[model samples]
Target: MKVLITGGAGFIGSHLAIRLLKEGMHPVLIDHLSEELPHARKEYQLKQVFKTGPAAYYNCSFLEREKVSAIMEKEKPHAVVHLGGLAGVIPSLKDPSAYIKTNIDGTNNVLACAAEQNVKHVIFASSSSVYGEQAGVPLSEDMATGRVLSPYAASKAGAEALCHSYRHMYGFQMNILRFFTVYGPWGRPDMAFATFIRKLFHNEPITIYGQGTGRDYTYIDDIVSGILLTLKSKESDVYNLGSGRPVLMSEVVDEIKHHFPNVKLLQKEARIGDVTSTWADVSKARVKLGYDPAVSFKKGFEETVAWAKEHSDLI
Candidate 1:
């Protein structure tokens, strides 16, 4: 079957596209190559995984309704994996308007295009940030999104609602994945793992926010596996893509020090829009999607360290 993956040149997008291709599915990628990220990563994904020529790449913004609609109509893909958005919490605070427009509006455009084009299914890449520093431990999918502290979280929540509305009215299947702290090889440079790895490599001090806040750091492989299984199930549902095991920021720092040995620490007050902790209760994903994360934080971190060392030139 043919699939359309928005943000297909990105970290999770590139890896997910690779996974679909390996399963003999053709993925048409729509991404804005705005020179925002390192060109090396873009070249690697475009050349390595998509080199076989079964893939199509469109360097267009998803917020442009006419452009997205035209592409969606032409492709008429069996499924649309909507992974495009204005990422990062801190940046969302700086430019809430841009985040709202790109994420919420862009998501609306994708849903509208999918509904109009009659795509079989639309899968959204939501975020655990929507939980918004919940008082409860092991946040569940059923929990109400009560006070979104950041514009980024609000946009993701809005996107989820839009997808649900389309599913309810149009009978289109929509799967929303609330991915938690995804990290590993080919991960985004903005994330903690990549930033920390870069600092370690440069012998620069790594910053720790919220005095070692805890997080459920899910690996890329496990998150991708959950997405693939959810696609096969073909059900309109929400699932938590996370390791279910939380790691404190201090613990992460300690682990990094073990690897780098000379890595210095620069403690800082928690930045605004930062969450103190995040833990996911994956019971729903386990039962409905048959999802089970196979990687441990320790193992995943070790592997990521190795990747950082090998790809030092790129990092």
Candidate 2:
């Protein structure tokens, strides 16, 4: 199978590309290498993917409809995985327009191009943020969306709707995966775990917000596995790709302290748009796609820290 992944140079995208190559599939990647993140980090990720195996790459934004269409026409991939977007709840609040434009509008372009090329399968990368401020634990796909707390969450919800519409009209297989707090090697630097590691390495204080909110921190490998399963499935539906384990922020801090005993801590009020907790109910995915997350938080964190130490320059 030939697969095309937007944001292919990103953390999850790069990992997915390497995995696909190992499975004897061709992977084509498109990434604008956004200014929000360091180009060095993205370039490093690409290097890792290339080192693993051969893959085609394009440095272009999906926002450019013509370019996206041209790439799709040229590649004629069996599947398209849409993962490009502006991420982060706090950053979304500061500039909601950017998030809306990239997440929603950019998604539309990808889907439109995929439909035009008659792609067989399309996987839209949504987020757990769409479940926003739920009092309930273990969020499921059947739950209502658009109760979003942040513009980023709203954008994902809107993009999911677009996915549904395109699937209905074009009659193509559509799989929407709502990812939780994914972390592991090559994780985004803006993520809480990444920031904590960076601060600790420099002997700087790490900030804790909102009385240690809980999150379902899924490992990057698990997420990639879930995506691969969906790619091979004939059925099209929404699935939550998460660990189904919620760990409090305080617990995460304690885990970090285990590595860096002298690490300083700073407490601060939670910023707006931050959810109190996120827990994924992967029952549907388990039954439908045999999606099982293997990595425990402790093990995943240890591996992440080890990788961070080795590649301190990238972070």
Candidate 3:
């Protein structure tokens, strides 16, 4: 099978592409490689994927409807995984228009092109941010997402609605996976885990915001496993691919301190658009997609630190 992934040069997209290649499937990637983002590791991530195997790559934004359509027509992929978008809650607040344009409008283009090509399956990468400030502990898919706290979250929710509409009209299988705080080797530099590691390496102080809030902190491999399971499923639905356990920011900092004992810490008020906590209820995914996240925070962090040290120049 051939699969096309937008944001293929990104951390998650690159990891997914390598996994698909290992499963004897062809993976095609499209990414704008935007320079405006906080990270500049797109080239490094793509090199890692190439090390695993040869895959077709296109450096183009999905916002360009004609280019997206042309790529879809040329590839004729069996599935489309939409993962391209401007990520980060704080950044989204500063430039909500960019988030809306890329996350919502760009998604429309991808969905339209997929429908035009008669693609069989599409997996939309949503976020746990959509369930902002929920009353419940473990967030379930059935819960309402009408109270999102950030433009980034709102954009994902809007894109998700578009996914359903396209599925209803075009009669194609659509799966929306709401990812939690995913972290691991080659993780996004903007994320807390990577940021902390970089600071520690340079003997700089790591900032702790909002009284050390908690996050699901799901591992990259586990997320990829969930994606692969969804790819094989026939049903179209939403699932939360998370660790189902929230780890406090303090605990994460402590874990990093275990490696860098002399790391400095800075405390600051939590910025706006930041959620207090995120916990995932993966019961639906477990029953429907057999999604099981096995890596613990300790083990995952250790592996991530090792990877970062090995490739210190990249981070």
Candidate 4:
């Protein structure tokens, strides 16, 4: 089978690409390489990523409708893992228009092209942010999405609705995977885990927003497992892919403090668009997709710290 991953060079995208290769499926990846990452240059990373992998690469934006369509027509992939979009709530606040254009419009173009080409399945990367400011534990997929706290979350919600409509009209599988706070090696610098690691290593003061703002921090490998499962299932449904363990920001910081005994700390308000806590009710994923996350918070954090040290030059 051939698959197209939109953000193939990204943390999850790159990892997924390698996994698909191992599965003997042809994986085509297209990414804008927009983020200003701290570690290595995007070009360098892409070179190292695809050096020996049999995956194909296209350096472009998801908003490029014609190019995207051309790729779909050429690749004729069995599935398209649509993970390309501007991520992060705070960054979305800084440039909401970009998020609106990329997440919503980009998804529209990709699905339209895939539908035109009769792609068998499409696994979209939605976000837990769609839950908004709801006061609840174990956030479920069926819960009503309240006032979206950020443009980024709103775009994901919009994309989810769009996928539903397409699934109905086009008669193809569309799996909306709502992801929690995923972190691991090659994770984005904007993410709390990476930022905290970099700052602490540099002896810079680390900022903890709402100190207790917890997240269902999923591991990278586990998420890739879920994506591969969804690709095979061809189920038109929404599933939450999370660790099912909500770890607090304070606890995460404390763990880092263990690594760096003198790590400085600073507390601040959990800025707007930041949810107080995110906990996923993975019963549905467990029963349906057989999505069992194996990596624990302690193990994942340890691995992340080790990765940070090895890639310290980037940090």
Candidate 5:
């Protein structure tokens, strides 16, 4: 099947592209976020992309509804995995208008085109931040999600609403994949993993925020599995794609220390809109989409460290 992946050249999107090619499916990539990455990362991953050779590529933003529609009409793709948007919770708080434009307005365009072009299925990339600051261990799909702490979370909630509207108003299936702290090779530099690694390499102080906030740090491969399995499903549903193992910020720091023992530390107050903690109840995914996350934090961190060392120039 010909699958259209918006943000297909991104960290998760690039990993997805590689998997799709191996599975013998034609995967078309749209990368408006190429410049969003660190310069070194962009250059390195671009070379890797050209080396593997994707099925097709569109170097334009999905915010352009007319152009997005045109691409949808021309490609006539069987499905769309919408991962295009402004990312990061803290960054969203920095410039909410940009987040609204990219995450909300841009997603509406993608969904509209999918509805108009009769795309068979759409698997959207939503954030667990939509759950907001809940006093709980494992957040479930059936819980209320409107109590978001940041503009980014609010925008994802809005996008999920749009997906529901399109799915009901039209007939195409929609599968909302709520990803939690996905990390691995070729990951975004803004994420904690990259920041800590870069700091370690520089022998700089790595800051830990507010009682060592914990998160369910999932691996890239497991998230890709969730996406692929969800694509194969016909029913419209939501699933949490996470490792299901929540770890404290200290634990993550220790995980890094396993590789870099001399890493310095600094303590700081947690930023506003930062959730107290996050742990996903992936039971729905386990039951429905057969989404099983296999990589533990230690294992995943080791793999990421190896890849980071290889591309230390980017750090």
Candidate 6:
């Protein structure tokens, strides 16, 4: 099988590429590399993941509809995993038009191309941000997406709805994976985990928003595992990818303090678009996709800390 991963060079995309390779599938990755990521520059983890398999690279933006279509035509991938988009919530707040253009329009372009080519399956990466600041606890897939806190979340929700429409109209298999607060080594720098690690290592005061919002910090490996399962299942579905346990921001800070014993923190008001807590009810994923989070928060955090220490200069 041949698969096209839109954000192949990215954190989750790179990991997913490797997993597909190990399963004897050829991976074709398209990434704009729009953001300057110091750690991801050399593709260190990406190289390791694809070190032993057949892989192809394309430096292209998803917004370029013609280019995306051309690549789909040339690759003729069996499955399409669309993961590329404007990823940061804060950035989306600052530049909403860009977020909408990329996240929503870019997704439409991918789905349209994949539908045109009759791709067998498409696994899209949605966010838990779609839940917004609901009064409900343990967010389930059935809950209606509420007032989007930011353009980023709105784009994701819009893209998800677009995907459903394509799935229905084109009869294409689609898996809309709603990811919780994913964190671990090879994570995005824009995320709090990476930012905290970098700031603490540099002796810079780390900012604590909402005095530490809680999240279900799903590890990268666990997320990759769930993704691969979805790919192989060859079924269209939506499942939450999370650890099923919410870890508080204060707990994360406390863990850092325990490890470093010298880190400084600067408390601040919780910014807009930031949710107070994110807890996933993984019952559906467990039953439908056999999704099981293998790494606990403690283990995952330790691994992240170790990676941060090794890549201190890069971070």
Candidate 4 global lDDT: 0.86
Q: Candidate 5 — what's its lDDT? A: 0.87
Better of 3 and 5 by lDDT: 3
Top-lDDT structure, candidate number: 2
Candidate 4 residues lying further than 4 Å off, grouped into runs, are 35-41
Tens digit of per-residue lDDT, candidate 1, span 148-252: 789999899888888888899899888999999999987788888999999888888888876647999999999999989988886788899899888887778
- Local accuracy of candidate 3 as per-residue lDDT tens digits, 97-171: 999999999999999999998999999999999898873399999874568999999999999999999999999
Q: Write the per-residue lDDT of candidate 2 for residues 41-77, one digit (tens) a residue.
A: 9999999999999999999999999999999999999
lDDT of 6 by residue, 1-315 (tens): 899999888888888888888878899999877754654543675576568687988889988889988999999999999988778789888899998888888999999999988898998999999988863389899874557788889999999999999999999899999998788877888788888888887788888888547888899999999988888886788999999998887788879988879988788899988878889999999998888899988889999999889877655
Clashes of 1: 0
Give the alpha-carbon lDDT of every model.
0.86, 0.93, 0.92, 0.86, 0.87, 0.86
Q: Could you tell me which 10 consecutive residues in candidate 1 have the lowest summed lDDT?
A: 45-54
RMSD of each: 1.4, 0.9, 1.3, 1.6, 1.3, 1.6
In candidate 2, stretches whose alpha carbon ends up further than 4 angstroms from where it belongs are none
TM-score-based ranking, best first?
Answer: 2, 3, 5, 1, 4, 6
User: Can you rank all candidates by lDDT, best first?
Assistant: 2, 3, 5, 1, 6, 4
Per-residue lDDT of model 5, residues 1-315, tens digit only: 899999876888888877887887888878765467865665565556666755788878998888888998999999999998888989888899988989998999999999999999998999899898985579999774599999999999999999999999998999999999999998899988898898888899898888848998999999998998987887899989998879887788778788999988888888998898899999999998888899988889999999999879875
For candidate 4, lDDT tens digit of each residue in 127-193? 9999997655888999845568999999999988899999999999889999989988878778888
Taking all chains together, each candidate's TM-score versus the true structure is 0.96, 0.98, 0.97, 0.96, 0.97, 0.95
Off by over 4 Å in 6: 36-42
Question: What lDDT does candidate 4 reach at residue 129?
Answer: 93
Error of 1 at 136 (Å): 5.9
Best model per TM-score: 2
Clashing residue pairs for model 2: none
